[model samples]
Target chain A: MDRSQLLKGLLDIIVLRVLETEDGYGYQILRRLRAAGFDELGDASVYGTLRRLYRAGYLSTYVQPSESGPHRKYYALTEAGRKYLHQMREAWEDVSAKMRALFDIAENGTAEKGRA
Target chain B: MTDTPQKNTDIADYRIAVERHLADLPASIREDLLNGLEEHLAEVSADLKPGVPLSHLLGSPEAYARELRETAEFPRENAGDRFRRSMWRMADPSFAWARGTADKFTGSAGVGEVGEFGRTLRPAWWVLRGFIAAAVVTHIFIFGNDSLREAVLSTGFFGLLFIVAIALAFVWLSLRLGVRAQEWSRRSRRLVAASGIALVAVGMLTFSWVADGFVYYREPVVGYSTAHDVVDEGVSDVYVYDENGELLTGVYLFDQHGNPLYLGDPWSCDDGRVNNPFEQEEQESAVPDPFAATTEPPLDEGRYGYRYPLCPVVEESTGADDPEQPASEPSEEPADADPSDEPTETPSRTPTPDPSAAD
Candidate 1:
């Protein structure tokens, strides 16, 4: 899959899952997404998303000042965010299953045409 | 493969970026996120490489932050709260009052030159002053000096008292009449009607003077005298006759010659039809010529003998020590009375009746 295209709706789940394992700041979260092969992710969208999620109550946030520069803000998934992610995962499974079934029918039909 | 911890320096740089980007966000959110990020950096930094950047491990700041974006949950928009704030901003008290004042100035009657109330009042005041001046001037001129002096003097000698009283009356009348005339000016068909009233008063006064001088005083053959009379050096005896030449009444006049001049009765003058001296002959002839054969003359309009003419008696010669004869007193009796009451000789002196009392 083109990771950039496939990552659209998956970033939220991915970020939530990464934060679930351990609380992280924006850069750490970005590293995890890149390791997962989503190279096209943009910084504005990620930071904006973090703020939006924090405002929505899915993520609790905190800031710690650095000796070298300005402060850093960290986000951690809430229980609600975890529960929501689980539901989203289940929904994704059901939709993928339906899509796979449709594709199977088309491939089987085309294979019979070639034999003919 | 990616088990290494992020460098402290890289993490710190990323935190600064995030903090800068989120500056305008709500105070609580900004503070909380900043604090959390700082703590996360401390934890991530200790085992990290001295030179290896966080960007090398995280792909890039753009990719890292983007991955966080799709999952973030934002608060619901509070439209009602925003709307209330906007309404409060709109409700400026001074501006509202100013708008109301402007509306009233435009909407209310009067206050401006073109306003209904002012329009009415201005024209009316103009007319009222004109009318009052014309009327007062007319009255002053028609009655002339005598009546005015009498009327003013009769009021009293207190100047300030009368002035204040008149001023008060003038103020009250001006207010009332000014208002009324203004109203009429607006509604009347002819706005100049007020001028007509003033003209009529002036015309009437003019008529009075003209008629008195030219018509009343100048009636033909009628006695004329100044308001005062002088007793001349007089003959011992005097008498007055009527228009019919009958002796009416007289006092005595003695000449300077110490002689009584039995001057004929003072009241008789030549008897004939004397034309009205005040009227121009052309004006007189404009009436149907009595001499005209076509005229059916009216009985009362005919010219007749000296209609109650009066004459003065004087000695034939001028001399000293002439005793002045008392002026004749106007009789209260009818003008046509017979002159038989004339006394021919001097009578025993008795207390003369007070002249003013007789009047």
Candidate 2:
């Protein structure tokens, strides 16, 4: 299984979570994602996710003129986006806890079988 | 931070490449996908080391576009789309190279400015397209029999005004459509493009047909009229003579206007005895013998002018007496009488002897 394939489903939630803290432009959001250890994340993937989220009313954009370069279009999370992100967080926690419990049970069972 | 002009162009080129890949999508969707792409590219470029190519860091433009499309949840490619994509893939390299060469040449030759100047004339193209569309429509629906030019020309002042009004309406609609094209669905935009191509094709064909008609009408009619035998009296051979009663050989005849006088069959010997097989078979019950030697007339050296002594074999055999024989053979009694009456008379006498000899 490809890590990117796994990342694809979570991209929406991750992008939303990133914007939840503060407003960020395309490159800024990408840079934050990279710093968070998504080294394999594609630049277009983030941009595309932002566009999808913006179209879905989960994000809103504003053009801020920069002094050095071109004008930056900043993406901010909407109220609905925050609520959606909260639900995703809960779902992620629930799945991870179940996975951890399963892993522990398997490990203990293997240890007992080896001793016998 | 402020970037150099070269960097800006690189970013723009990359963005354009990506946009071209996503061209199949609806304009609104495509625009949304690419909205902040330029600024994003710039920011990425700002962090890059000097002299590093953008592709080295960002991957191929094609891959970027693919990733973008996939992430955006744009509809998956169907078989038709896949086939079209494969075809494009085959042609893309050469097309890209040609485009790059053209861009370089234009940039170096100052033609890029001319291109920019042409971009400003897009509205003119739209207006011309409208006029073409109107002409095509009118030609098809209103004046089916007439060529486009004739239809337009024959139409009086009011008709011209009506056509102009129709063209203006088309222009107005085209302008409105162009303004809102970005909001239209992909299918509708494709339909418009296909119609535009169709209009242009029809306009070119009709205009070219009209142009050919104009050329055809302007041509001199005399050439066509005199292309075959000038005299319709079925004179298959012309024999000319001087005042000394001597038959003239290689004498070229011309009309009063200095145009070459072309008379007779010019190919077959239809002098009274040696008949054209087809005509003889048709007229008389004479079944032409296939093995019988039919004399071939002298080749017309002067292709335009009528040359004298059309049948050289007959001329050589009978000498000056040949003219009288051909003239009187059709009328059996005249043969015997013509020889005795004018043995030394000019060859012109032969023409008057037998009126039916013209056949």
Candidate 3:
């Protein structure tokens, strides 16, 4: 399955989860995501996603000026965002477990037909 | 650098579109976006194959504009919505002109009689002071040389008047324009009011000076006549005078038939020429001397008397018993007259005595 298709739905959650570990700039975050094997993320698309998540109140931002280059706005997750992420995580796990059980039943029924 | 003029125009248009796109983002975001976009365009152009349209190198300007519009609070289209969006502009921080005009009126005329009276009194006093100062100066100047005093008094009086008039005109205009409210402080209002009062005061003095000059320059003449019984129409004589009271000329008064009546100085005639300073030469010249003896018919008695029509005539007198009695006399005249000579009571004569005048 292509990760790009699923990436849009989980982008806010992913951003919050990433920021939870360590605060990073856009370029740094992009590099980390790429290293973790999500290369399909477009540079503009990631920035747009970050802005949208910040506007939605899941993330907060502050700018730290760099001596050599330009300033960067760093985003961090809030308490409300952490609670939302946890709820989404639990729901996703429940759905995955239920689907697995249904697949197991179907597999068992097909094996019984092959034996007969 | 080697691009044709058309290509240069195209590049400028592209730069404008890209700059507009970048402006939608925050300042921290915009700078990098602009540099990155320009670099992307340059890289894409360099890597392009021959004869491709440059349009492919850029996205739609509208789409980029839409992204920027999402962040900032653009003015709303509907009037009410726009008003609502800029509600902060209506707050105290913004409405200074209204508050300033209101706040300035705190210690003004309407506040109380003491404050208002003080303001009114101040202007009046200032005016009085100015006039007194002008008068004292004028007195010293005039009394020092009686010959030059007349000229100095006349000119000084008129000069003070002119200043006062101009000041009054300015104050009137300022009041009409509601100028006092615009002053940011109370002190300025007092200064304006004081000066304005002084001006009106000086103006009054100037008027008196003009009157005095008129008296000094006025020429007097003799030979007066009283209007006796209706002096009939005709040209008559009247005399003119100069500032020194010397006779200037004999003015002629004429009837409608062009006849002259008692001719001499109008000022000297007590058969009395009408005192109209504004009368034209023709009106003065055309005045008929009713007292002049001529062939023309005489004016009726009504035109000649100190008339109170309700006044009791000799016949109306109750044989001079109470000389003050009026209404009881005129009505009773016909009753006492010889009945043969009289026509009893005529309808016109009885009602002709105006009831209002009797009352």
Candidate 4:
């Protein structure tokens, strides 16, 4: 299966993890994610994801009021976001275990026996 | 941004393009997307050569919008969006611009001029708009007793209709003011500013100066505490105010010179909303103009006397402080005060059902 579909949903968690370290701005967050080795990540994707989280009360925001052609919008995690991250981590662990078992069984000749 | 017209137009063009695609999105999302896009564009532009366009760096505006749409995790599941969608259902049919209205502006020469003029008049339009918005906000949050609010808040089947109607009018005006001012000339901009100032002045005048400046000072009129006394004494009076600031009880209805009021009939629509007026009936004519011919002539005939061949015209010089006007205090006329000398004095002072209107 193409991992892109799987990665799409997990990107939100990855973004939250990045924010968990320190509050970052749009372009900064995108840079941090790229540095963390999600080399294929798109700029619009990261920014859009941040907006989605911020709007849903998963993140709190304030303007930097920077003197610029454009003002920087800063995003930080909320208490709800912290609670949410814990639940997502547990759910991820469960999914991770189930996938490992499936991979191991398929590698063992169980897949060939089932086909016969 | 302190950019040159060249740079500003570049960004403006980009913003407009992005907004065009975003017309169907929620306002909050569109705004966030724009802000993020703006900052990103600015940062990217900083690294570019002076003559390079943003499109050269970011690729097509259409592609950017599509990328944002696909990637952004919009909060589409919220109840707020549901409510907004419903409000749109009510507002859109009446106020939504036709698809080609914008294209028509650029396509036609005559329309372009009219559109430009409308944009020039925007500053004035905004003042009146601000007043309306403030009025609605105050009505909802500050005063439940306001009549405009009451009309909207009326219970039962009709109330929904009233609420919908008010909301429609509000949305229509806002949507109608879509003309952007970038293309307007400096002279046109100044005209807009001047008209805005003029409107504000006129608005201030209505607070107290209207009706020929009759409400020059606070009247020693009746208030809620004295409502019983007014009704018991049977004074069917009328009130005219500039701004509906206070239902001021102590208002004098005549000009400083105490000439009979040259004011119009009381506006009862916005009246009696917050405070219960002493009585809840239509105000009787304050001026008794016997030969005024029309059922309602303005109070300005300011008569110490009239020279009619048949009818006597009262031309009494009574400003607010006419000394013998202890006589003006009572609702009834001093039967001896010559009618010709004081035209319509008593009716103006006392709030009484006009005997003439009955006729």
lDDT, candidates in the order shown: 0.50, 0.68, 0.48, 0.55
Better of 1 and 4 by TM-score: 4
Which of candidates 1 and 3 is the stronger one according to lDDT? 1
Task: State which candidate has the highest DockQ.
Answer: 2
How do the residues B85-122 of candidate 4 rate in per-residue lDDT, one tens digit apiece?
Answer: 66986788655565346547654755464457576676
Which lDDT tens digits does candidate 2 get at residues B1-359? Answer: 67887787888889999999999877878887787778788878877776676777789999999999888864446779878977987899997888777777767877584457466666776777788878777777667756665666677897788778887898887767655764799988788768878879889997798887765543322442442433344555656433333444444444434444455554455544333322333423453332224322223323334334444343333234664544333344424433334434432332223433323
Q: What's the true lDDT of residue B103 in model 1?
A: 58
| Candidate 2 residue runs with Cα over 4 Å from true position | B74-359
- List the lowest-lDDT window of 10 residues for candidate 2 chain B: B289-298
Score chain A of each prediction against the true chain A by TM-score and list the results. Answer: 0.82, 0.94, 0.79, 0.82
Off by over 4 Å in 3: A1-3, B1-359
At residue B188, what lDDT does model 2 achieve? 87
What level of docking quality does candidate 3 show? Answer: incorrect
lDDT order of candidates, best first? Answer: 2, 4, 1, 3
Output the lDDT of residue A37, model 2: 92
- Return the candidate ranking by TM-score, descending: 2, 4, 1, 3
Q: Write the per-residue lDDT of candidate 1 for residues A48-103, one digit (tens) a residue.
A: 56666676668997777656534566789888788867877888889999999999
Question: Model 1: how far is B38 from its true place, Å?
Answer: 4.5
| Residue-by-residue lDDT tens digits, candidate 4, A7-115 | 6778778889999979988777877987988865666677778777877788998777666545666889999788778778888999999999889988777868878
Error of 2 at A4 (Å): 2.0
Task: Identify the runs in model 4 with alpha carbons over 4 angstroms from their true place.
Answer: A1-5, A65-70, A110-116, B1-9, B47-52, B73-359
Among all candidates shown, the one with the greatest TM-score: 2
